[model samples]
Target: MFNSFLKLTSICFALLLLPISIMAQELPSSSLYVVTSCYVNEGSSFLDAVEEARATIPNDDNAANMMFFRQPIAGTNFEKNQFFRVVSWNNLQHWAQPRSLPATQEYSCDNHNRTFHTTRVVGTNGNTAYTDTDVAFVSARQCMAKDGVSLSEVYDWVDTRISRGQASRQNDNTMVQMSHKILGASPNVASGRMITIRRIGDSRQGYARFFDEQFMGTRDRTLGALPDAPFEFCTDANLTESYIVHSPGRGI
Candidate 1:
């Protein structure tokens, strides 16, 4: 009887590990994006400074592995000096390394202390359109959900919205390409949060198109939808935007 109990305990342990392994497999290594907030010192072209330092920055394998940039357009909540630097990588192993970029005298930065949730490729115009785009309009929304709503459920709802939006648009080039992922660690401001990024041809128009297609439409259909209301489940939704800083010949 004791031997049988030991075998049962082993099986439970293996079962517990199975989901973790499966989740790791689901996370795309090639789809990593790291965003850091920056505040430039008074009277300086922050983008140009970072651009100049790019060449001289020393070997920080993790930082060097990905592209860097500043996000310019944002909501009123974010200050004018605020910007975001984004990076992409292949595989979780590379992401695990300590990423370092120089904090020059030109600017100060605030980094997110979290790992990325699974990345979903909403749709692509061509295989290379995502990388080829000049700028990306990233919408970062931080919020928490009502009681009993699981994180996986939230992801499922988001995935559905992305799929429907992608399908609605016949021309991928005309509209923005959208994708979203949750933050693995809880953000300081909220119980849960998500970053939604769209690689688009124009920031202003693309931003408008996203709202008309995704947010407004989702709001209208929530009650009638099969999976039920996703947006209504959350409170304190704060959205802010950023413009991508292009790093040529370096992204995946």
Candidate 2:
């Protein structure tokens, strides 16, 4: 078992260094993301599960990047020992490539329950030095477009928010990503919900400072009110401890 694990790790490492060519597709402006929830088996530690999952990363050139997130058990509806793995693809055509996971004692994840998101970054603070070991705080929420509001208008609202944060000097280490569900469970597909993800800082302290500035400092008053609501996002946001398990040098 030890030897097999080492072999798998080596293969994955090699694949990680390979350059992924951007595939020719109709939607060159965005990338496809697959988010999968993983549950660690009883008696297996989260670190063990992470190592096991890392060994199974797809080697195809279509696979752009992969990230692992440890979901908080408290204040969330996730089951115990739940983690998330998000994979990025160059295009939808490459997503059709056959992939499977080998049985593992550390954890079990079902690819079928995966949610597909078509994502594009709407705002950033210009800090792009992303690495595999970098840790980040993510706040995700589901949103629905307001009546008669186009998707572009919704994105413009997001941009305006980022601009406010920038003016207040509160978004130096933040990135805002907007995603639309292309394929997923019935509820998500039927609702036509959009996902807003805010990746704050490269470490836990960054998140701490962000909140402190928002609540304790005077910056909040200067940021100004939000523009007319272009989308109605859920008030309850899902927070996660996101870790970059594998980064392909492209800034997220």
Candidate 3:
């Protein structure tokens, strides 16, 4: 009888471990975006603007943006150097979706009172026909298309931060918001401070919705906002961290 009891215990442990292994297969990853402040000087030439952007970009990655130029009459008086920038992040779903980052408005420095129009980019024909999405697409393709840095370079940087390894109940409450901005934002997430998630050998699938830099960690249904909020944050995963989220608000 004792021998039979031992065998039964072993069977139970295996059964429990099996589901965890299957869930582990569903880890995640995602894409995101960031808006940064860059300065353009008055009377600076177009080449000067490009050089300024090059200096500001952190790395040699060709994906780094240099900004865009625009003018009103398609004339070359003082319009060629006027432009702004947009950057991208792969697997940071909320940011990469294209609409999250707003485009820069035209401001003037050449005309003393800084008079600027709702200026648009001029082709050889001087037409303001470009949409915000058009500009975004140009920057996106520019970085990934040519001799630029690969997604792996960015991944390598993020992976180093994934050094923390602890296990906890999968909190639908936390992490969703962090995916948009940065990781381990605890003060905004759980208990209000960013911290790396612990290691987990098993995985579980669930929805993630809502993101605010201030929201972090696991929140309770009775204590905080809706746990199963009505949206999806973003989605993608890896052995170290599951960056993707499929909350049911937007991507139905």
Best by TM-score: 2
Give lDDT tens digits, candidate 1, residues 1-252: 999999999999999999777654333223665656677778777666565456545544454344555455545566777665556655466767775555577666665553453444444332333344454444444334444555555555555665666666533342322234446454443544444434443344454565566555534544433436444333332333333333345432
Residue range 28-85, candidate 2, lDDT tens digits: 2777888888888899988787676566655455555655555553346788888887
- Clashing pairs for model 1 are 29-91, 71-243, 72-243
- Give the lDDT of residue 89 in candidate 1: 57
Weakest 10 consecutive residues of candidate 1 by summed lDDT: 170-179
User: Each model's TM-score?
Assistant: 0.57, 0.75, 0.27
lDDT of each: 0.51, 0.64, 0.27
TM-score winner, 1 or 2: 2
Candidate 2 residue spans exceeding 4 A from truth: 1-28, 58-62, 126-132, 186-191, 218-227, 248-252
Better of 1 and 3 by lDDT: 1
**Decoy 3 TM-score against native:** 0.27
Error of 2 at 144 (Å): 1.7
